[model samples]
Target: MPSGPNSGRVSRSSGRWRWSDATRETTDTPTAATLETERMKDRYGLEVSTSSAEARDAYVEGIDRMLSAEAGVEDCLAAAIAADPGFALPHAALARQHQLYVRPDEARASAEAAVELSHSATARERQHVEIVRLLVAGQVPQALDLIRQHVIDYPRDAFALAPACGVFGAIGFSGRIGREAELLEFLEPLATHYGDDWWFATVHAFALIETGRWDRGRQLAERALEQRPSTPHGAHTLVHALFEAGDDDEAVSFLEGWLPDSDRASVLHCHIWWHYALVLMAVSRHDDAWQAFRHNCLPGTTTSPPITVFSDSSSFMWRSELAGQPRDRAIWQQVREFYEERFPQPIVFVDAHAGLTYAVLGETEQLQACLTELQELGEAGRLPAGTTGATLGQAYGAFVDEKWSTVIDVLEPLIPQVVRIGGSRAQRDLMTNTLLAAYVRSGRTDEARAFCAQVVDRRPTRPVAGFELC
Candidate 1:
């Protein structure tokens, strides 16, 4: 057996290849073994220590599978645990899965198990465990603070950095006014540590584009794809940069080529389709946009959680309505049915979207029920006081009742704080559009025109088809 860059021991004979079992020893010490996969390494270049070499291989495989949004991630994690019961990192990874599934109880249990087993794990593994525990416990501020320090202490920890810089990451969802600025600044120092690395370059490009540095962002994102053409994160960043730069032709061409090969099980797959639909709409391809929406980004079309599915579906319907594209009202009813069955609670952002659906569909009963839920949540301190759910619901109810003045009164005060709902600026613009439409419907054309000019001045790239200055 021969050993080299990877932890595995390789052998060659008669044009055949095999990994030698010599890498494994029946020893009590946690040690690197031959079970490491060929050409696999963590961001830090260390082989994960485990009693069973197969467990180490399984853990590494699971992490890679997760990055590509492949299926069998849980099966891989379970294999790791079955191979080595005390492996803490795999348990922490499982907690992330539970978190995304919106099963907080399961997430908490898995995260606690990781913490309990961390006493014998490496320092890096222990830190990862802490991160999972804090996130699952709903201690977001503490989790974010720890992530910042963890990256500084272990700059090569992609596990920590990915979640910190991701589109739905802690900082991305933090609701800070200058979030893009903060992200770009934070990433600059880490460049020296992760020079030209594919994933880091992709995330940095996203931050750059979000901060309006489109030229540099485009260059970096394209470079990341050149190195790894199938990198979904790179493709996602490039799409955003292209859209923001007003290169609609290139954006459409790139996404059309990219989406077919994207893993359907991956969370980003539907989101990339959402971007594709927006590009189609930008070019007056409304029918094509609706086709994309119905076939891919719609709620029942994908396996994404109700929260994510609702966000994309509601935004797509509203955008189509803005373009004067005719849609069956039955789609609205189907969406409302799904929302009622899946999400009975007012989960801040989900509530905002559900309220939009109910108002657009004229489901007065559901709209009133949403308001009732928000009021109950607010009083119990489950949701923040003055949450967007509460305000957006009020605005929607008023819009339905033709009390447009009351809609403006409820929404205008909260527009600045709407970022608290934890979506991208593009997504939050749904609320702004709703408010502007309310102004138009109420015959406050003068105020609506002023608002349109202000918004167009602020976001020149945003489509302003419906808010025409008539």
Candidate 2:
């Protein structure tokens, strides 16, 4: 909520004045004056208009690092801000980084600074700051509206395109019906402007996969990876393309090959490993999958946002549980500890995952605490997806209590709208799987069989054994 700024503090990156208008007199800063002699344009052919060449170079490199899942993006962004404190785009970029890192307070501060400073920025920089501000505020629908115009105006603004076109992007995560179609429609037209751009290739490939263009998506992902071997977004798209194409073996091999050097701080770091774990689960390699979870996905292993950590860890455990894999109580204990440390309050998706751990571990008090809060939030109409979450929290409690009928009653009607809570089809399947399992467990054989068939038809390539009622 920090907007239309007045000299606020931006959370420091490395004990430095991370956000300040350092010597903006132009004449006073001799070094900036000297460095400003040469000007360079951005990828969109828009002049960066920074006082320091080093800052411009660092900003571009930082963007690449972030897109590629490499380290040093923070350092580079910090350097850019230090060199040119009034650079609105870098401030905007820093805002995005802060949001990704789950420091919303810092993100808003940076975004506000970007907005205020953007008055003097070029049209491109202003656009960048505005879009980023919308993103930081979780206004995806509005951000998409702006991005639609942005693309028409500056189709080559690949940096702006990155967040808009990602698999976990505003469009993908918007929970709108026909999101796949939306992604395809939004990205397909702009493909010409971003020819061979590695980030663009990855995003377009993901859109293709979502829209059922699996072969083309895979080919594009592969080409992108070839261009930038460390491109995590490309790797992510390829994983999805392979999954959709029913090629689990290649998916496993590809992820394993990349796991060795996956940057711990990169956005895709934990998520790629999550994909690897899912592929292993698909192959029924439970032990290896658990190994991956322990090594790559345990709480402290990577710097993925809380949302990623919550989904990946909870889904792994829930999937394993559904598969009848023996529970590692120690890891569950670790997961519980991690959850407690990170989430004292639960959003809908995070709440359900927290309920999973609490139920499995018989932590009744913890589960009730989350449920109580969720119910309160739901009734107040402040929750994103309405009262379904509160109902699910109750369902989870009933599920733990072995009250299968209660679980079915709560979730059956809500199943159609499950995507509203946000998460991809694959991720939301945890809820569907739970309902199916509950039906079978409750001895409702006919209903269980019918639901199982429906699920199989929807995800025909999934391992048949996982969907079986018996």
Candidate 3:
């Protein structure tokens, strides 16, 4: 057995290529030898440290389903643990699932279990478990360092590499300027290791689209969807690329066709519907957009994580109002209540949207309280997104008070740092649209047209109804 960092060994046995840990000893009996040769591997061809085939198979199914945002991921992962109580990877995966659903305590518990069980596993599995443990414990810097090293050693370990990949991933939320370019740089080198893989293509496409390489992103996204049509991530990435290219017609058509077959209980379901609503708003289908929001994106209706529910619902309503829809104070109050219930603390992304809700609803007390918290977090250097959200929140408050110049003064200088708040460029358009509306309403027509031209240089369309300057 080889004893080094590259400890995964491939050997031809029984007319098949099989992967095995280099540390595993060869068995004498033919049946035992064959069983060892045929040990269960995951969909990514990484060997899982589980003796039970049922456990291994269930773990693989659960991971695939989780990556694609399908329903039944938790049940599948739970079944894997039920089949083999000591399978470390399933526990690690369950921790990730719990984190995705915003169940932090359960995530930490499962992460601890994974770490405990991984002591007897391979070095790769042990590292995987440890990274997940760090992530669930909110030790993101350590987890990211470990993930970088782990991927270099075992690039096919997709789950281990997942924490740093997407917009909400560690890098996206790193509060670093130019993080979009950083994400593309991080993923581009790994392309060879993940050729034609649906998950890789989807995330890579997203990074590309976010960085303004929409044409290349669209090609990859299309291929990813063709490779796995059921993958909601692929579909979501494709729409983002389309949205960036200003192809609202095709974007809406594709989503309307694809959404019917998707599971509403899935992770990206509400978000995907939010994307649909955005495109509908772009095309002047305001009635349809409102219907879509009411059905899928409303607080009571959405089954998304708390962050998604709050950000998506609040942003959609605010954008609708900007598009000349009458303000529905009742709906804004419902969104405000949901935000208060789900997130009392100031997560930079959620707080950014919470500001809009509070401003629109005239909740001056709540708004001031949130602003104070954000200011303190920023002053202490505790805010991962720095003061971007706080500044934007203040801008929203100014906009609500009809202080257009104040909104311009606060928001224009902060535009460069807005990416730190961690959402898709499309999602952050809530802020951009706000600034544009401020410029227009303040009779700063020249500045509005210049800003609109800059936006058009990046994207082909500006969909805000009343603030169209081009």
Model 3 worst lDDT window (10 residues): 1-10
Worst 10 residues of 2 by lDDT: 1-10
lDDT of 3: 0.82
Scanning candidate 1 in windows of ten residues, the lowest lDDT window is: 1-10
TM-score of each: 0.82, 0.83, 0.92
Best by TM-score: 3
User: Cα deviation in Å at residue 307, candidate 1?
Assistant: 2.0
Candidate 2 TM-score over all chains jointly: 0.83
Q: Can you rank all candidates by lDDT, best first?
A: 3, 2, 1
| Residue 336 lDDT, candidate 2, scale 0-100 | 81
Model 1 lDDT tens row, 400-421: 5778789888888788777666
Scored by lDDT, model 2 comes in at: 0.72
Q: Model 2, residue 195: displacement in angstroms?
A: 1.9
Where model 2 places Cα greater than 4 Å from the true spot, the runs are 1-39, 138-141, 439-470
By lDDT, who's the top model here? 3
